[model samples]
Target: MRRRGIDALTHRAVAEEAALPPQTVRAHLPTREDLWCAALQYTLTGWVRRGEEFIDRLPEPLTLEQAARAIVEVATVHPAEHADTTRATIAGVYERYIQSGRHPELRPLIGRYNVELTGLVARVLARHGRHVQPEIARAVLAVVDGTVVYRLAEGETPIPAAIRALEVAIPLLCPFPNDT
Candidate 1:
């Protein structure tokens, strides 16, 4: 699924990729939609896990800049480690974004993802003994997402742009001082 889009997903192809029997793949996936759902969930789950791990590894009493950097890294660096993986992850993300618009069932999942992201930003703010309005947090997320989408589309590194924007906005959004 990471290597190809939903249309290319099939029990036989999955079995071939997994080096398992087609019957076993069918018994597990049952249908193309089921397979696609599982594959998408699997990718998201892995990404979330890595993100949690990255947050867990942060030093105690995180500074505002550190917290902001963490969020940026989780949103970008941790999801895509290599060129191919980066392309695949971007493809999956845009595909889901398009699918959510066309499929109402996915809107709830997308909403939940947004809520979780908001909570993450809130937690990061709290850890630094700072507070940002929900609107500001949402704006920060929008900046991050927009930067990432731009990077994926243009095949350019937009980290400097994102960091510069965050450096400028975070202090204004919260009471914390920019140590960097």
Candidate 2:
């Protein structure tokens, strides 16, 4: 349901997709909203896990550009593992969660996950020390996200372009003080 969108998914559809009885699906999920939320949470957990794993496998003290390149490479190489559409959907749901009066229970979980993602980016930027500020770190992330979205939409390869762009832009955006 989360992959396809809520408007197009029904309990029966999910049951059929899972090769299970509707009753069984109801027994586990109970409500369409619940199912959607669970699917989103599952996807979010997977994304975070995959990102952390990629970071872990890399050598320590990665430069800002290297960290950014590593992340984009990992994501592009494993599109199935980190679907761009799913990330966009999660972002939408997160926005809705903030506006909705109900579902206070979900806010903490979503907020924490968002913070985790931001902290990962911040850590990468920290390697550049005085060169990169919090705002610049955020802008870098936005650029990376936009690049990924464009690549996905166009069905074009982005790993090389993303790496090159970031490599060139990072130094300009956060130039060494002495060089200035």
Candidate 3:
């Protein structure tokens, strides 16, 4: 679904891509929606996994900007060595994330991921020195995700503009640091 959208995810196409038989694809996916759901889950899982890995490497006492940077960066980025291949993968992931909106059943999955991600953000910030309420963490996510979508629409990478936006939003969202 990276080169195209979910519309292009046919059993035959997947079979061809996987070098497997069409019947095998059908047996696994069962329904077209199941195929789409699996594809969406894979994309979302990659995104979430990258974030988790990145945050684990960070130092404690993380600032809001650092948290925001980590959140936005991990969503669409790979380390310097992996950038070329991962760029398309990340784009596919982001596209699938937006495309999930077309299926109403997928929204709860999206919401659950968002809540888990937001909780991670809040926990990471609080675990270190920086602390923000869950509401603020969710707003921080909105800023990062919105900036990513905007940059993607403009054929730009999301990191730079997203960080610039967070520089602005972080202060607006948290005027004073909340005590741990």
Q: Model 2, residue 2: what's the lDDT? A: 43
Q: How well is each residue in 57-153 modelled by candidate 1, as lDDT tens digits?
A: 7786887567767667565534222434455454465566666676564566667666766767766666666666777778777777787677767
- On lDDT, the leading prediction is 3
Q: Is candidate 1 or candidate 2 better by lDDT?
A: 1
lDDT of 1 at 38: 76
**Per-candidate clashes, comma-separated:** 0, 0, 1
Off by over 4 Å in 2: 1-6, 63-65, 73-112, 126-134, 153-155, 174-180
**Candidate 2, residue 104: how far the Cα is off, in Å:** 13
Alpha carbon lDDT of each predicted model: 0.67, 0.59, 0.71
Tens digit per residue, CA lDDT, model 3, 68-112: 566665545454334334445556656656677887756767777
Q: Please give each candidate's TM-score.
A: 0.76, 0.65, 0.80
List candidate 3 stretches off by more than 4 Å.
63-65, 77-91, 177-180
Runs off by more than 4 Å, candidate 1 = 77-95, 102-105, 132-135, 176-180
Clashing pairs in 3: 61-129
Cα displacement (angstroms), candidate 1, residue 66, comes to 1.7
